[model samples]
Target chain A: MMIEESFVNGNSLIHRLNPVLKIGFAIIYSFVVAVSSKFPSLFAALFIALFLVILARLNPRKAAVRLAAVNGIIILFWFFLPFTFQGEALFHIGPFAVTRPGVIFAAGITLKANAILIAFIALVATMRVTTLGHALNSMLIPEKLVQFFLLTYRYLFVIQTEYQKLTRAVKVRGFRPGTNLHTYRTYAYLAGMLFVRASVRGERVYQAMLCRGFKGKFYSLHEYSISKADITCAVFMTAAIVILVVLEWTKII
Target chain B: MDKDNLIINLTDISFSYPEGAPLLNNLSMQFYKGDRVGLIGPNGGGKTTLFHIIMGLLKPYSGKIEIFGKPVREEKDFRSVRQRIGLLFQDSDDQLFSPTVLEDVAFGPLNLGKSVDEAKVIARKNLDSLGLSGFEDRITYKLSGGEKRMVSLATVLAMEPEILLLDEPSAGLDENTRASLIKVLTGLDLSYILISHEMEFLDSTTTSVYIMKDGKVFMNGDRQIHRHYHIHPHSALPHRHESGFGKKYTDFLA
Candidate 1:
């Protein structure tokens, strides 16, 4: 029940775009943004990512929450970078000089990370993870790797359920948590039991697959077709990536 | 019964885990076409292990196994057996690996070399038969326990297997769901070896019962073998029954 694919349920243009194209473009766009050091290019990248997010028609509050989570981690960089990195000393913080370049460096990282993550959220996260696996397969990812990814995603819920059951069993037996060797040992045993059960379940799952005539090959039930909208979006996104790269290397911001 | 009608034949099958106690010792069992057999036993009684051996999921260390009168040996031999006979695992979580119900049901069909569209059609038809018609796109793991079990059955039935090996198909089902399950099993034309502990359910779904214990078929008789097959009313007192397995299987109903 906790498997929340928050952005997947939508009829937005970005959501309708071909997942293979979305994944491919997200990778290319992220690469361009990552190497772009100039503020103008980074800001342009951020603008494009935000534009895609807007095109996705995601709930504004949810989008804001996702951005907040990204920035929360970036805030840790803000704490250290301004005072640590060797650069032009701007001011003193308790005898440690805060460098202007360090602040700028951190700012650039914040922009780059947000730009890439937002684009990924808008393009890639809008599709179900199962769809992503099939898309990756179509995009020439190794079949074994795709199967591994999909199977892992599928069993995560089962493993979580097993974990909850073990926790509940211990809790009902009056097991209380505290900083003690007994607690540590009990937790270790719980974790160990989870792994053992998971492994056993894995074996049974494989056997079930065998029962169903699962040879080495995996067949996807979904067949994705490129619509006119998908083609138009693909062209536009390709153009955007080209423009971002051009802007990074050229003076024409 | 003629040997030609034997659906599954296991003779002197002995299986044991590595460095563990014997799980199945000299167990022999037979299934004829059109036979609805219910296998029942206590925990660790090798009921599941025997099912595994029948499905070729586990190979007996020493035994002779045959399926539909064909001698099944080598790893390759089980492929055709799997194609002809579907095994529904005890755990729906294990049986359903696909993310969606449709995909999971379609998995077996697709693997059996059906075209994607053909497999989808079969999957849909099977789901419809199980009254899960509108659940094509439902996430597999998000389904309620009963719904998951039904979908798991759909997955197995999608293969159009000649025989079904259901391991505890009614384990976690509530009364209403279990009743519906019994109805479904009783209505199916295909033969199946249903493994369940609920005597009433087995009595309702199967024509015969085989009690497995000490790694062998301890008792085999008609469905009326156990007098406890009747559902005791809630107001009834606790009682014991002679299962003819030389054991007093007690029912603490009050």
Candidate 2:
């Protein structure tokens, strides 16, 4: 279901583009935005990303909720950084002081974090993980690395489901966590059992792979070539980033 | 049975867990080309263990298995033999680890060194034949149980295996899905051995039946034997006329 919800949208142009192109465009855009120290350039890049999100027609409110959650964590780091560092104080509080340079540094961090997060969420949330793996593999990423990513993504839910089942099984067996040695031992035993189950399942999965004639490689068929639209999109985005960099260097945008 | 065309030969096969619990004991069987065999038994009867043995995924503590007249002892022998046979696990989630339905279906063929385009063609044909054409892009985990089973079958079928081994092909399936599966099984020309407790489905789809009890073959017969035992070909197990396939078969043996 993760794959279906991630890809297979009904009649969307963005869905039709080769996954490799989308990933390449996203990486290039994010790198350019992250490398730019000028606020204006970063802001411009953010606007273009926002425009793409709108064009993709994803739920704005959902996107906003996810963005808030990610940015909230970064903001925690931002809030604590100034307090932990020694700098010329703009203002003094009971135990902490705000400084001008700290604020600028925090602003830079916030910009970089938000830009990367937005770009990633825009591309990843819209594209299926499998498609991303295929794209990466076609781009000549190592087979082992691609397989690792694929297996990790595939089994993440399996492990979580197993954990849920274990918890349910324990609860059914009247397991209670008391402040006692027995309870701690029970918990330790359960954890050990989970590891053993996962490892055994992992071995079975490997055997299943071998039975299917897997010979140390994973293969996918993605024949969609980079079309004129893809090239145009990549080139146009690259040109915009260049303009932003030049404008920022000249202090004129 | 054509002795000359025996595709799978198991002799005195016995297996036990590392902890000394018995699973399969002195089991022997033979399957011929183009045979439609159903393996049936109660729960914990080692039906799956026997399938794994034939697929060479598991080793027996004793006895030998010959696939296409070649003794299977090592993984290297299994590598060549497994290519000739396809095994569909009971759990589609276990069988399908790929991201997309299409990729999972194409996995077997691609691994057998088929070109990407050729593999895609075969995968697409199998998916389409299963009435799952547009579902190629769908994710494997998100599919319904029936759909997942279909895709699992497609994956194996795409490999063009001569022998198909299915473990509980009808378990967890709805009536309509079961009927569709029966249709698929009946239509398939390749030799297949299906392990299931669904007597009706088995009786309807299989040319011969082998029941496993305590890890060994308990009964072997044809449709006439099933009919004489009053096993309905359309009803689930434990029919009112009889205690059940499991109970009746066990009682007969006792």
Candidate 3:
């Protein structure tokens, strides 16, 4: 599965932190990482994020795989950003110029992306997505957004399977993609069919939910309580945020 | 409970879709205590629609529905009624909506305001009863059709409903799984209204048979009836009586 439900169940400290607190930390940490231009502070933020990945007991290979896709985007920035900007020319191909400022901007974006990606892979990947909706609701995020997340999470896999089945059916009929109007029209029809099916499925699912006594409000079966562990984790996260902010502002690495 | 007491009484029930043809026309029926009624019909015969009406998912245009002597009208009224009466959808995919089998089974109890731990216990008990003890953690979509059907049943049974409306429980099962389902369903003590096209499966599980045809229902007098006595599945639930209606309806065969 290219898109994975990647909650690595574990008993590590990062895994046990309150989801609300972890989300808050990720947001603030990403913001700090984004604002920093200094290499030392950016590297320090990356190290902290990596440390959390270790604390969460995530498999290194799996984390690397997740990062690999993001790193591809980062590599694209290097290709274009370093050669496009007009600045101090650091080097040259026969006709093109590689500017120092362009290289610096590209490197900074790469650092910010890596730091934020690692932080999210550690903090968010430890949560089962259904409960993440509950946590988002408890954080006083808009009810509609939470509901949207929940409904999307519930049906995305079903829709993916639907699309896969359609593709297989097309393949079985010897429909190969070429630079032709037939292939494009076929794809358009497939998309239309999927949309129609999804709409019908949505109505049926809504009716089923009503039959089960859904009263326009979703109640999470898990009650939210602030335990001592959660409290301690909150303190730890606050300390981590302070350290990150200090590094960003002070440039002390 | 009195043996002859009517559990569900519908009088002159008439229903139709908006701008569509009428499905139920002046259909009146009475389900007595312990009536294991089987509803058999062809497609578009309104069997599933009737099930929805009983579950309060659809409203009849003109009728009075009394369940345990209480009238049902709005959504709130049905909320209380649904707790005591479970409906198994024809599509197991629709019924088992939760991501995992365990979560789906526990959904009803959790909705009833039970704590997670208590709901887990009820879910496990139901799963164990259905011979699905270790299947709890399996992904809902990854399950086989038979396993999905069993898990759906477990979800309903977890609610400890007094009455069950099962729609086409054996529609897509193989012989072995269908027989296993038959055994589990037949072993249950509570009354259920089972809708199926399979006459042999219905004959094996249901005490009485009704045919839905021409926008009405009629009791089948041709099939011989067999008496079945069952012990209460749970002590906390009330005992079920062998419906007196079933006996009188069977007399039509004689």
Cα lDDT tens digits for candidate 1, A115-145: 9989988998899999999999899899899
Which CAPRI tier for candidate 3? acceptable
Please tell me how candidate 2 rates in CAPRI terms. Answer: medium
* Shift in Å, residue B104, candidate 1: 0.7
- Give lDDT tens digits, candidate 2, residues A1-253: 2333432353455666677877877887777776778777777777777777766777778778768987888788777777666678878778679776777677777877777776666665677677678788887688789989988788777777777888889899898889999889878877888898888778877777777998887776775687777777777767877876785677565
Query: Which TM-score does chain B of candidate 2 obtain?
Result: 0.89
Candidate 2 lDDT over B1-254, as tens digits, reads 67789999999999987887789989888888988888867787788888888878888889988989889898899899888999998878788888888888888989989999888899999999888899988867778999989899998888888999999999999999899989988988899999876668878888877777777885456322264344347757644544445545445433
**How would you class the docking of model 1?**
high
The most accurate candidate by DockQ is: 1
Best by lDDT: 1
**Which parts of model 2 have CA positions greater than 4 angstroms off?**
A1-18, A32-38, A84-88, A94-96, A171-193, A244-253, B218-248
Interface RMSD of predicted model 2: 1.2
Which residue pairs in candidate 3 collide?
none
**Can you tell me which runs of candidate 1 are displaced by over 4 Å?**
B218-223, B226-254
Error of 3 at A245 (Å): 1.9
The list of candidate 3 runs beyond 4 A from truth reads A6-13, A16-21, A142-144, A170-174, A177-182, A223-236, A251-253, B1-4, B115-118, B134-138, B223-254
Candidate with the greatest TM-score versus the true structure = 1
